[model samples]
Target: MPQCAIITCNNTHRRTKGGNVRYHRFPGDHNTRTRWLQVCGKTVPNCSTARVCSRHFSKECYERDVQHELLGLPSRCRLKKGAVPDTNLPLDFLKEEVLPGSAIDILLAVGLVPSQPVQKVSGGLPRE
Candidate 1:
């Protein structure tokens, strides 16, 4: 997934010049980056266009993936020792890549980790 330099506010009515929003020519029906097309053999209305599958994907899935990635970033210990983090890898790849007790659920399941701290809406360390 591509990380954006700007973070958008949660309120849609409030507009700003930042967020992960982007524009690319996507297939009209798809909402994800999957390599498969919606129609098995039938081509898209426009010939010679390949697109990520959007039909099966929902906004919730996207959000879940995003949350998983965000949570995973701080959980991975290998990145804490001043090494370059592997957070750049694809979310699917990260899910499949095996490292012992590295997954969030697994870490919690074996009682090897504590719950993540709750996020506050405001008033913490001043932004640098």
Candidate 2:
């Protein structure tokens, strides 16, 4: 199942109290994608596979009549074009910004940075 990208949301393609939910793919448009990231408090490096569940959006975002037509089908919940999440979201979703020269410090504090710099491999793509 495609999991909802929101860290705190447990919505998937399952039926919930609200009804059958949908998982919308992250926008191909960068600006819209950024807005989605901000709403969910995510810093996803690449969102090609990211999806936001229907629960995160308000009623205005969906075409209820169209979606209602397909209520019993495996596929339900049709959204409007260029739709973006605008409800039930965190206003402050992102962690503190990583300041210049402090990323390593923060990573180290969280034990993510290596003890030493990793050696660069010389066998990948050719340099330009």
List model 2 lDDT by residue over 1-128, tens digit each: 56688867877665454566678888878787777787777566668887888888888887666455567644446677777877666645543564456777778777796565456559854444
Location of the lowest summed lDDT over 10 successive residues in candidate 2: 91-100
lDDT of 1 by residue, 44-106 (tens): 454234222222233432323445476775221111111111223334433655556658868
Scored against the true structure, residue 17 in model 2 reaches a CA lDDT of 42
Highest lDDT: give the candidate number.
2
For model 2, what is the alpha-carbon lDDT of residue 92?
58
Give lDDT per model, in order: 0.33, 0.71
Runs off by more than 4 Å, candidate 1: 1-21, 27-93, 98-128
lDDT score, residue 63, model 1?
23
Model 1 lDDT, full chain set? 0.33
